[model samples]
Target: MFPEPNSELPEDPSAPEEAYLESPHHGFQGDRGAAPVQAAIPAALTIAVSREAGSRGSTIGARVGQKLGWQVYNQELLEYIAQEGTFRQELVENLTPGAGRWVEDRLQELLREQNLSQHPSIINLARLVLTLGAQGEVILIGRGAGCILPRASTLYVRIVAPLPDRVAYMSQWLRLTEEEAAEQVRLRDQRRANFLATHFHRPPGDVYQYDLLLNSSLLGEDLCAALIVQAARAKPGALRGKGL
Candidate 1:
């Protein structure tokens, strides 16, 4: 298995609007109710998985989605954003590569230029995530989905691994030397931290933001997914009538 990178930084913090514009995951434009896939799934449970770089959060999310037979909102978010905004698919894909500095910058600009109303993409993405939560089971990975839909009947999870473990994972996955992986981790973590701080004004590692924090290296992906699924099922009224 290709080890995932340890951290992913936002492309640029100064121009979030551009980031939103360039992002394929921002939101769709024109017709408001275009994404019918969200409506097809039955309402049951919603899971939001946030993680440090190289923590295997995406793997865990995919496993959870498979076990539950629910839609996994991972990279598919980019497609949604592209469709919603009527942006060229290729441009969005290029912007979303790796850390996504260009996309982040665009996002910053959008936030500054137009209040939330003007940038329907960001608002709609948030709304769509919430709508998915309301309609059926989902596993959302990253893009501040956890923070945006805090009150929704959702299980917010954070997955982290020790620095050494993350570095090792990245080295193997990226086919880089250990030192190179370490450097990449440092830069990526810094970028992600800055993005969260600059845009959301919240610390990225805030424990209060997550319902549960799991050490992926310790528990492994399958166990972590099982734990999340268990928690989601056990929590009463977790996904009731909550709204964004």
Candidate 2:
């Protein structure tokens, strides 16, 4: 349905420093490189994990990806979408071997289907999620991904903890003072709430919409990821990747 990522995403040797700062992943695979995803993911399952800031959502999502041999799409989706000019085109162009054209063509189709053309960021984001959803074998973290992915085939999960617990975790992880951590938590929550409202027309922190709701503080990150892996295995319309 879209430009699929390749298993081995080779880095570009001559990419500018700014692209590296923006991508975090291997520099967008240019013509010298191939897609950054597997080829045979047409009918696999997807997991959309939404979590409170500092809840280790990205950490757990990475764990799930490792255990399941899938790709985890994180904040880079939002970052890439936010860019303008050469960067945006560069982002799309770095996918499959010949994906620049294919991605553009498919993206236009999605924009037309959803009747959205105003916000480039939202449109690119929609392109990322929908294409990843169609190909499957993805664990998408944050950015209203749970609300956007096709429900029937996607395992939507929300990970949360008490505000105090999240603050403690963030403080310890980022080496911030407790007061600073608490404020960061509040800010993160408010920002996500606003993003959800503005982009997806949904409220943040709504557990009712998910396939499973997990308390990471209680269950712990490893256990939470294990459970998500188990649940995703059972989701219908999905075939486990080549092995395991």
Candidate 3:
């Protein structure tokens, strides 16, 4: 959909001091104390993403958000869900792709041991994805959001890089040994694949499910974000009623 484009480039509801989340306008204000403006924020546009581990998907998403002046929901989406629901932060954090298979398996075992078959985080995540997607103007990263949202309403993207490249990126980003980064990449990739397969009954890597596939190693994060912004702009309803 992008056809190769050129590269270019918080707050919270919980506290009174945090205005990013709740502020309808004034997103560019230095802080909460800055003078508020009456500018209207752009209406909703949905971007669903699936990414290979260490591909800098989150970084690219952040850049894309900056370009579009929208909010990027990566791990922060999980935090929002935890705050909105009754689940504790620890349990919500444990639900991430970085948690590894053994930890998730152990958590399931503990749940079964207690005879509580349903996990709260799992139950909350799907609903959260759909609700957030519906809200629009949100960049949904990970959590298999590409599979959950309506195909016509969302621009689904998949990010990938060669295994060696991914490992190197992860090692540098996390300051981990090359071997450790490789292990992390492998585990996270498998874990996310399994997550989508188990919950959505679809292979996470199937090409047909996504409208765009990006290689961050080849394009770099900046170009990747530029490409996505271009693609999102091209989508049918993305520019419906606002100045994007």
Question: Which candidate's TM-score is highest?
Answer: 2
lDDT of each: 0.68, 0.74, 0.72
> 1-244, model 2: which lDDT tens digit per residue?
5436854445678887667566646666546666576454225678988889888888999999999999888876555654544654554454554434444565566455653344767776766666566667888888877766556668999988888899999999989999999999989989988888776667866778988899999999899999999998776625234233
How many clashing residue pairs are found in candidate 1? 32
For residue 163, model 3's alpha carbon misses the true position, in angstroms, by: 0.8
Q: What order do candidates take by TM-score, descending?
A: 2, 3, 1
Candidate 3, residues 1-244: lDDT per residue as tens digits? 4434553212345667534335556457545685766322122468987889998899899999999998788966654764576544344344434333333453455345542225466545654555555446889898767765666668999999999999999999889999999999999889887876666567877888888899999999999999999999888555454543
Clashes of each: 32, 5, 1
Could you tell me every candidate's TM-score relative to the true structure?
Answer: 0.63, 0.68, 0.64
Error of 1 at 244 (Å): 15
lDDT of 1 by residue, 68-163 (tens): 888788746733653575443333343323224423443455456542233445555544554455454778887666655534456889999999
* Model 2 whole-model lDDT (C-alpha atoms): 0.74
Candidates arranged by lDDT, highest first: 2, 3, 1
Task: Show the colliding residue pairs in model 2.
Answer: 5-37, 6-35, 6-36, 6-37, 7-37
Model 2: residues >4 Å from true position, as ranges? 1-42, 81-117, 237-244
Against the hidden true structure, what lDDT does model 1 obtain? 0.68
**TM match of model 1 to true structure:** 0.63
Could you tell me the lDDT of residue 138 within candidate 3? Answer: 87
